[model samples]
Target chain A: MTGTASRPTLEAVAARAGVSRATASRVVNGGDGVREPLVERVRRAVEELGYVPNQAARSLVTRRHDAVAVVIAEPETRVFADPFFALQLRGISKELTAHDSQLVLLLTEGRDDHVRVGRYLAGGHVDGALVFSLHLDDPLPGLIHGAGVPTVFGGRPGWGDGPRDAVPTVYVDCDNRGGARDAVRHLVGLGRTRIAHITGPLDQTSAADRLDGFRDVMVDVDPALIAEGDFTPAGGERAMRELLERRPDVDAVFAANDLSAAGALRVLRERGRRVPDDVAVIGFDDMLPVAEQTDPPLTTVRQDIEEIGRLMARLLLRRLDRAADEGPVGAPSSVVLPTTLVRRASA
Target chain B: MTGTASRPTLEAVAARAGVSRATASRVVNGGDGVREPLVERVRRAVEELGYVPNQAARSLVTRRHDAVAVVIAEPETRVFADPFFALQLRGISKELTAHDSQLVLLLTEGRDDHVRVGRYLAGGHVDGALVFSLHLDDPLPGLIHGAGVPTVFGGRPGWGDGPRDAVPTVYVDCDNRGGARDAVRHLVGLGRTRIAHITGPLDQTSAADRLDGFRDVMVDVDPALIAEGDFTPAGGERAMRELLERRPDVDAVFAANDLSAAGALRVLRERGRRVPDDVAVIGFDDMLPVAEQTDPPLTTVRQDIEEIGRLMARLLLRRLDRAADEGPVGAPSSVVLPTTLVRRASA
Candidate 1:
């Protein structure tokens, strides 16, 4: 036990218990069919010998590794920078652990790795997959479906119609539209009419929904102020600069994400504008670092990313367990978790 | 293909390939010594019939999944909030992908998941594991090694001598001592005589080494100016406030990590102290958001977390391949990557 000596195997336990290897494995793995007397004998042997069943051997019988793949479509740098991914990862890790599953993180940004990921999933290396950060018309969803494996996308895939090809998918989306609208409404409530918008990449559904929410509210008020950004601080800075050059008197801004808002804050500072007093800045996706560390701590929309991860894992696990017996376990359901407006110093 | 369809088994592929099931499995898995003509026939049959071999079946023959687990010991909030984890994850993901290995992320903070993780690794669920954030006397490194698994720790495991067990570990650390010394020396060169040190958690090797480095430099300058923090923003703020109360004449501060430095900055600002002009601040482990978003930005020591991850993965892969030929790999080895002083508005 203290040195590099290998632990006793199932065969040794079986030999000690005077039972067959199959009976020993059955008792160790807690299979239901073993007799009560044999179970006790095997259990005592396992305790005495301190035998841990080889996981590889068990996986061979079960044909299930009890692992799930979490695929992200962003560069490693951006993924780490965004607190949203971490929160979701934590949530997923927690839920997966409850189900005795492991989370395999797959970054599919590079073209070569992306193809390899498709083949890996298709090859049945994982029990299921939970994909995040899907771009519109992304090939992964279809590729996964074509491979006959169960998958649940984090956000709604670009496929407009419900579950394409009968591939069961569970989309856990934040109330991007409502959250963005609420953010803009808060600005309007503050009596700022010349409000501009800094949006994320238009290709992403989150970006589109948020931008649409901003436009929907703005059209009812005034549609003259609109600027697009790529959901980055630099993008926000450039967008804010453009918005200012277009309308110097713009009194408020709604950035689709926190980094962009931080960028807008930088641009505002450079232009000698006071936050909240001169320009009320609001960002979505209440990312932790930017939300708290912003000059005037950013007032933003808080999306419960951890909850999203938990829900996605639960849904995928359900599908993995009952896909054969009960067909798809849940409805091709879309769960939109609520987003609340966290009013901080900036807004 | 449209509805839920059971995946084709090896038996199905064997029937389709006009060969025995064992022969088909060997051909599909690229087993050596197979005749070329039959191999060509098997390959064509696999492609034509859209047959994908289950990884479990393939693993039985090849005993390789080409996957490794990278375990982080922090909670989800901390994992995401700290840019260091993200950078390292990205680096490991990139390197593993290059080696055609999958990266599995295992978070061991949740106590309930501990058993599942232990079983997963011990069961040969992964080829090897790379673990991060080990406190002194932490049981995980020993437990993993005890299970006859190959593992690597992200940083020094706080047991000053090195890993106590014969587990072959590759530790990727930053120049904590040099970075801390340089930060203190920079403050000294700035003509700030009364410099106070804010240290990170004493248990972590980085924190301990940094504290040692700071003390060494301070002894050369003045050993009287020293305090301790937990590498957290609140901790830094508390430490800074205590230092201020203890010595109001303290002109400069050196924080062990960036979060604590950010905390220090907040406290200094609340007390109406101007950065650099009044009390200059320096931080280590230059995490992106905190450093960038802090007012006037932060001057800190930059550790390449991505490189650390990449190196760790490469080392683990090498260890895994080497162990395949030899018995278990030998004692743990450490790799200390270089860190640079990033000058910004803080110091």
Candidate 2:
């Protein structure tokens, strides 16, 4: 049955409160310039009648929906299986809840969804957006920019070529380069003589930055020590296998992420090598499930994935607030939060 | 600056198309009773003008929003850290996408959030809601019910004492009891006489049913062989520790879920017990990351988690469709999907 048709009306509330319709309307709209006694009476009447304000009616006047779209442009299963994105969502959800804003999730499988999403954003269903454009080739940033919604991105938007659009993007990301350097430095401090590196799908900026950080630490090291991975356990397993074959004397490995590092750990265990004795392993993104549950537990780079989500919301909210108050929104400065190395049994 | 104010209006499209305002209105609002040629002309003008229909205004007339709210009642970190919820969301997203509906996520932290969500559902912001209330005392189910929104619950709801509400709820849940029985039967077939059982949080129906399933197979089993687990890795580790201490010679263990199974495996390894040799182990849910990544993998019950989410959306969509077409919508049937035993190395 349609409850919408049976909901209590504003007239009923005014009648029950024994106030004029205009006074009741003013109190209900937000009690602006209305007496406290009338506001309380109307509020009590609303509660008793179970009257819910029609959002559609209010939104027409306010041009604000108190909702934000969160666009995740990854078709990968990692978006569902991995803890990385989930933590970020938790953070985003918390921030939005604080601001009394709803989170409209738009999960795009591919290009067609991008067009649909672009149209939806341009449709003005929500106030603004929080986008996660994970890959360099992901066209979401450009599409969203064209849609002209006030947006804060989860990570820095980088195209394969030069800047795709002239618009400045505001984003919050962890310091992948700095985090990778800390991981390698820790391994080096432990006196690992033959250190190897596992690279993620180099297309992603985070993975690319991490590889660069590894290169920064191991200048002039044998190229044979570097193995390519795709930020997956199977990829990590294959890369670890390849690295062992290429450099059998390798004493340590810095994996691109925890999932890959978990796979490397499995390989090390299967190969009859004692961790931290025969081979020390460190990973990026200290995802608790993988990091704490690993056999020897993982020593990995700690990036506050949730904080990135929270900061992204905070920045977007500020942009929305400023724009609501005055004119054009000034380009908010982007931020890269620092990372720390978490020591565990592996190293 | 605000693009909402600068957006192309319906009047602009009408003027640009060289048509009457009524003709353009017909074309923009689903092209009902409009000529094909005029509809084509109006569509072109709309595209050229980059016009987007204002959702608030449209909703005021149509009383229909092609949007669905996904309310996850768990304030626990599991909603974020566990792959269970994520997989469900992915399934819900896919189905909703196919139906041209937006997925609005509402993650509640506690009691106050329950009140907020109840109000939001009553506000008629979304067409319907897919709710996940993990615990019996969650209060979300009762609140959402009173809110009078069209709802389909993620799992079968059971109050601690008697039926909490008069409304017959429609839900989508896997055969948890059957799955548990299958797991126990498999362990029994393995010739493990002294089998231990680990239960999830008993307050929930799924966990309670699982414990009953274990009993359906292991009648008259020693009380010491059964241990309580909270469906977490730490809880699993603790339960296994207690079980091993009470019955060291327990030849097999059946955990409530893969998380606890992984935790149990950790304790078994640390205590120098070889898997499948010293103590054969089985878990439920067959969650890929936990099941496949664990040492020796895990033989467990496989429930179609994504299908549950997809089916929930299907049921709600069907309900919405019926309500739109008819006067009073009939109650849609609740569904219980089948589960199968996934054999892996642990058992």
Candidate 3:
């Protein structure tokens, strides 16, 4: 073994082992090549010389930073306030940590920021990219793919035209339609025919799917009672107020998210509507703390955000590993995790 | 100016400017040195060559990654559920983006993970670190300091002791005590003599400080009415139930946070108590959605979470720059932002 006097360089190891610098580097980096006896001799020489490969130098040779960038297409304020983003981030971080890769998080607020993000991703700054909360017609997918990097999306793009090109992408999504259907079914089971719907932003896939599910369920009952909310509490409150003004006899409401549901509940109370007595309510995406805190609680759809995040990370890693040697990597796959209805007093 | 067709190399620029490779590199990287006329010539050559120095090569020479790691010391599930964490992360991301530096996100689950984090920080993987949600007596601060890397904590460590070392840290905290006092005073003004307090985890600085403020305010009124919760909805529900069982005459409660306050409201509703008219309720941390969701709404203390996060990032950035200039950096510093009382329907 080498003494503590001075550490030897890769050149010293190569000279001692009577090998070329390239051969020594390949052996040191665990790259394929060279015979067993020569490899053994190089290994011994490396141990004796105590040569530790510089990380920066190794990174240059490998062209792999072992880092993935997570791009959030929203304002910083909205991204932080939303529990879904945080939970998914946590899951991504945990899974990435296990794989010994790094996570680079970026938030794009405006068009200029989007351009900067496009340039950064295309500039070989990270090995792969994960885009979250994408809108329907967002040009990011095209831009990121044009950069010639592997990409994965958190949720299915609202456009839902399927993967456009040979650009590999894995979509991790919750069962939005199934969950919304279950929520509406529960309302129907309660014998509430005049059920009003408070929908999220129509441009979002989750919102559209949830609204469609609600309508599908309502066609069997009545489709005349529907309104829209932007998934914000204030928006829900306004929607609830509008529905009440339009149809004062509405007996139930299905909100696309817990925040909107909670808002609807608040407005209902102000109008002297008793939860589950005068008007039953159910929400989608059972967010923590707030869901539990809702007076009379809330019957909602539960999406496993952490699990979704973990799955997204795994899919990205698989794509990065070039596992699909027979074909292309990550062949535009879609993964829809199951969601269940959480029953509470509200419904 | 260099045309698109005639992009010059560093070698070409050096030859044209009649300077050495080292001199040209130093000039291009904005490093100190070189005579004025030669520097001007090199600049002209650079403009003429359109030679954009590669990031990898520049990072190797400068040993600066221009990246900061935001370490969240919570499990993935909790990280997503807590709006406070989300807001803080968003704020940090925004500031880092504006600075044109990348943000790396890391979460440590256990003791072993902490060691890995230490190596990651010490190996010059990042320029500095911003840590959040530190539990009382957590050894992470010491671990970070021992690694010889700079760290900025989100809050005062609340371990009842001072920082282990004089490591330069920047903290952005809310005026928890002042906000709590104002909340309790509002209850008192509403002619509620028997006011009970539901506090957050006593080990947290905000919890302890808010409780202290409540006690200080109650000294002029009565000190016998106090209860503690773990800053969770369930904890708040249990605490509220216990308070009611012990003292049914209690007419007012000041919870440490909006979630806990919402929990208390639920329990009160179950117990057939009317909010505001029967028992006025107040909560800290206005947490917009939660506050608006409560029955009769909720009067709360508003601490701008987004602003807090932004301020924390700015402060940490300053500390990072300072630490880089100096040697191992200095000890923990604190910055407290103001809080406002928001009146709603509850109290």
TM-score of each: 0.75, 0.74, 0.63
Q: Candidate 1's residue-wise lDDT over B1-347, tens digit each?
A: 22355655668667877888888878866688777887887766655455655665556676676778777766556776666787888888888888878676765445434445656667665677888977664445544654566677798776554344433346778888988888889998999888899988887888989988887777764444677788788899899998998888889999998999999999999999999899999998888777999986999998887889888888888777766666564633678988899999988
TM-score of predicted structure 1: 0.75
Q: Which of the two, 1 or 3, has more TM-score? A: 1
Give fnat for candidates 1, 2 and onward, in order: 0.27, 0.14, 0.10
Give the least accurate 10-residue stretch of model 3 chain A, judged by summed lDDT.
A1-10
Candidate 3 per-residue lDDT, tens place, A1-347, comes to 00112335778889999999999988977789789988988977755544555544445676666677888877666766667787788788888878877666765445445544654555455678888888766556655654555777888776464545434346899989888999999999999879999999887888999988987888864444778788789999999999999899999999999999999999999989999999999998888878989998999999998888888888888776763243343344669999999998999
Total backbone clashes of model 3? Answer: 7
When 1 and 3 are scored with DockQ, the better candidate is: 1
Model 2 Cα lDDT, one tens digit per residue, B1-347:
23533556788889999899899988876658888888889977866565656665667687677878898877635676677888898888889888877777766555456655655676566788998755866656654664667888888877532233344578899999999999999988989899998899988888898999999999999999999998889999999999989999999999999999999999999999999999999999989778999998999999989899999999999988888788445558889999999999999
Candidate 1 vs candidate 2: the TM-score winner is 1
Ranking by TM-score: 1, 2, 3
Candidate 3 CAPRI assessment class: incorrect
Q: lDDT per residue, candidate 3, B1-347, as tens digits?
A: 00112324678779989999889988976788799999999977765443555544556676566777787766555665667777777777788888766666655445445544644554456667788777665555554654454566676666433444333345778888888889889988999989999988876788888998898788864544678897778989999998998899999999999889989999999999999899999998888678898887999999988777777778767766665566444533678888999999999
Chain B TM-score in candidate 3, rounded to 2 decimals? 0.79
Q: What is the C-alpha RMSD of each candidate to the true structure, in Å?
A: 7.2, 6.9, 11.3
For this target, which candidate reaches the highest TM-score against the unseen true structure? 1
Candidate 3: global Cα-lDDT? 0.75
**CA shift of B196, model 1, Å:** 4.6
